[model samples]
Target: MRVLGIDPGLTRCGVGVVEGVPGRPGRMIGYYVVRSEPGEDIALRLLNLDRSLAELIAEHKPDAVAVERVFAQHNVRTVMGTAQASGVAVLAGARAGLPVETYTPSEVKAAVTGSGTADKAQVTSMVTRLLQLDAPPKPADAADALALAICHIWRGGTRAKIQAAALAAARRSPR
Candidate 1:
């Protein structure tokens, strides 16, 4: 399955596309960072983010979209911006008719690094090792986006199978 992972932020939104199945190594298809100036109006910033995400979605044609869920932050402005960026990502996925799932930061870290409390450096190290890249992806946002994709492929694929099997069993069982 191909998945587009989004790490949303008003200034630097990270995007990564990954292809793989459950219990197998995954490869990165593409990675990009969408930038918008804070000096710009919110509307324009959102538009820029939307347009960039739309293009990425069209280019990648992912089966699913995994977005980093916005969590509460000490700075209200920061939280608001992140939430707005995240909304744009979900909208893009819906427009493309793809399943969209949101994973919290801790969840993503745990899936990629085997610990929810893992630091960014730890997560980056694991992502570099897992993708077998000579070096870690530049800019933490890109690495975070790739981590989101890897997490989804490893976790979502297994979840999907379990749901499908349950549905099949329910269909065959007597009510």
Candidate 2:
């Protein structure tokens, strides 16, 4: 399966794509960033984000879209903008006929680093090591995107296997 992971931010959204065998861990395909002017109108920012995400979806054609859940207790404006960007990303995936999935930061961190309380540096280091990249993903946003992809790979595969097993057992039972 191929998955695209998104880390949403108004000014600098990050995206990463990974592909793997149906039951195998995700392997990196690409990672990058999308940026918009910091002070652009919220509507315009959303529009741009939507467009960029659509382009990425078209280019990658991932089977699923995985995004990080929002976590904020301060900077309501920033949080709202991030949510808006995330919505646009989900819409893009839906438009491409891809299923959308979401994971929390702690979930992603734990998946990648085996620690729910991992900081950005820890996640980045692990992502780099896992992907065997010469250097860690830069600009925080990109690293975050890669981590989301990894998290989904771990969670999504487990979920899919459980679903398949349940279906198989159900079929085996007398109806």
TM-score of each: 0.88, 0.85
The ten-residue window of minimal lDDT in model 2 covers: 159-168
Candidate 2 residue 122 C-alpha distance from true site, Å: 0.4
lDDT, candidates in the order shown: 0.87, 0.81
After superposition on all CA atoms, how large is the RMSD of candidate 1? Answer: 5.6
The candidate maximizing TM-score is: 1
> Which candidate comes out best when scored by lDDT?
1
Candidate 1 on 21-55: residue-level lDDT in tens? 86677988978999999899999999999999999
Q: Give stretches of model 2 more than 4 Å off.
A: 21-25, 157-175
TM-score of candidate 1 against the unseen true structure: 0.88
Tens digits of per-residue lDDT for model 2, 1-175: 7778999888999999877653354578898898999777778888888888888888998867888888777478689888878888877766665667778888989988999999999999998888778888888889899888877776756664454456556656787
lDDT of 1 at 55: 94
Candidate 1 regions exceeding 4 Å error are 158-175
lDDT (0-100) at residue 117 of candidate 2?
A: 100
